[model samples]
Target: MTQFIVSLAVFLALHSIPAIPAIRQRFIRVLGRRPYLVLYSLASLAALAWVFHAAFQLDYVELWPPSAWQAWFPLTLSPVAFFLLISGLFSANPVSVTFRRGDMKPGAVVSITRHPVLWGFLLWAAGHIVANGDLRSLMLFGCFALFALFGMVMAERRNWSNPLNASTSIIPFAAIAQGRARFGIDPAMILALALTVALSAWLLLGGHAALFGTDPLAMTST
Candidate 1:
């Protein structure tokens, strides 16, 4: 528990670095965007690894056995995961593409919210924590949920610079064509969906235990 708490605190500290535009801009200028992104990714992965290591080192402290109601976990998570994993895999929705395109249009998806990935991560984290009411499990997954939520806020604060005006950029296109506002379809998106389906099937079959050391479906709630 001590190790888990310490690692979690460190992870949050690393991620909670202030979101000042000037400081971030300076870092971008000094490190270059690609290098900075890579550095951030590496740092995040390291922190996550440390958290996982510390968590497993602690005894699996059961808070309470999952209730029968906990069966709702997969039902709730499936859709959220499907959208997030599929959106990430495919490139159909303008929301998904905006990140790839460097456009940052703040279209239908971004108009409502800025951080889809973080949102998805939040759902995933919540689902896991709810289904597994154990101290180790909660610490491990809850920390991630909190991190994702905070990361989204900090990240959006930094990216809030130079947002496109609705009148000139978004509204005109939305007013001109109903289809334009729609989350469009594309071949990449189709490919991503197809691949996700296949990967999901494979994971359920022979891949679950090999990868995670346990079968997901086997770990049913009481």
Candidate 2:
């Protein structure tokens, strides 16, 4: 579990860096915007990979075996995962589109909720904790879950609200569903969604060797 803890610590520390304007400004000034973004993104991805690698490499210890309760894992996780996946792909969402539009404005996403990504993290962490009952797993996922939840609430209250540009602002998912007629499905969007779903299914079906070097399910019979 040493590797697991180390990876989790590094991941959490990097992620938990509060979005201080001055700190962000300094980083951008020093590295220039694109380089800073690329470096941080790569670091975050590496940290996540390390966490999974550490977790799966652990010696078999029955902290908690897979139970019928874990049936809830996929059921609860599917929608949240879909949301994150879809939100990441679509250019229409105000949050995802910010970088492309030449705006580093923090409050664009905050107006809806301070951090949509943190919200996704909370969902993922909670789902994993429910599915894995081991002390180490529980502690790791639980702490991150709580951190993400608190981060969203704290950020909401701390950040300044920006005026919405109606032309660019995104409607909530529910609102979009209600007004579905106004939405158009482009060919590229359709292809992207199809690919994402296919990839997710492949990962779910013990095909991790193709992506992450080993099947995740093979690590747990519990």
Candidate 3:
């Protein structure tokens, strides 16, 4: 538990560095933008690996056994979560391709939420917390949920100075209703969405157990 907590702290701390503009900028300046990004990515992966190692080593300490129906929660939500993730991958937002292509217009995904990836992570984490009902799972998933929620807030604040992004929102379809963003889906995005659904199905069926040592489907059977 001590190692788990420490690993979690290290992961969160590494993530928090980007939220601090001065420190992030200083690192960028000192290391150069590309090198800084590379190093940060490597460090983040290391911290994430430590977190997973610690988490998987801990025995299941149940907080409350999930109700039978709770087993379906994550299963049902996984497709939607994957959709958001896939859409976010293709969305023209500050984080992905738009970072390089400054002139790119917001797409269907961004029309729903400026932070689609974060929303995806939020849903994935929240759904797991609802389904697992274990102390270790709660702590692991809850951290991700909070990180996604707070990261969205931070992202919005970071882009606040841009007039075009000013009216964009974190809430789904809010920006579209406000006339700040529009939805346009191309064939490529549609294909990506289909692939994401297939991947989600694969994960829910057996990939999750193979990777995490827990079968969500077995929970339903019991």
Number of the top-ranking candidate, with lDDT as the measure: 3
Residue 90, candidate 2: alpha-carbon lDDT: 32
Candidate 3 structure quality by residue, lDDT tens digits, 39-137:
987998899889989987889888887677887888887777778766775555553222112346655666677677678778888989989888888
Q: What is the lDDT of residue 198 in candidate 1?
A: 74
Clashing pairs in 1: none
| lDDT digits (tens) for residues 1-222 of candidate 1 | 787888889887755532234454476679986786578668867997888778778887789876667746854675555555445422212222122333323333333233444555677788878877898788788877887767656664544553332221222234334432344445544554566577667766767567546555666633
Give the C-alpha lDDT of model 3: 0.75
lDDT of 3 at 142: 98
- Superpose all Cα atoms of candidate 3 onto the true structure and report the RMSD in Å to 1 decimal: 3.8
Q: What lDDT does model 2 reach?
A: 0.55
Instruction: Name the best candidate (by TM-score).
Output: 3
Candidate 1, superposed: residue stretches over 4 Å from native: 16-23, 67-104, 150-208
Candidate 3 weakest ten by summed lDDT: 94-103
| Deviation from native of the Cα of residue 151 in model 2, angstroms | 1.6
Which residue pairs in model 2 clash with each other?
66-222
Better of 1 and 3 by lDDT: 3
Q: What are the clashing pairs of model 3?
A: none
The window of 10 residues in a row where model 2 has the poorest summed lDDT is 93-102
Off by over 4 Å in 3: 13-47, 95-103, 177-180
Report backbone clashes per prediction: 0, 1, 0
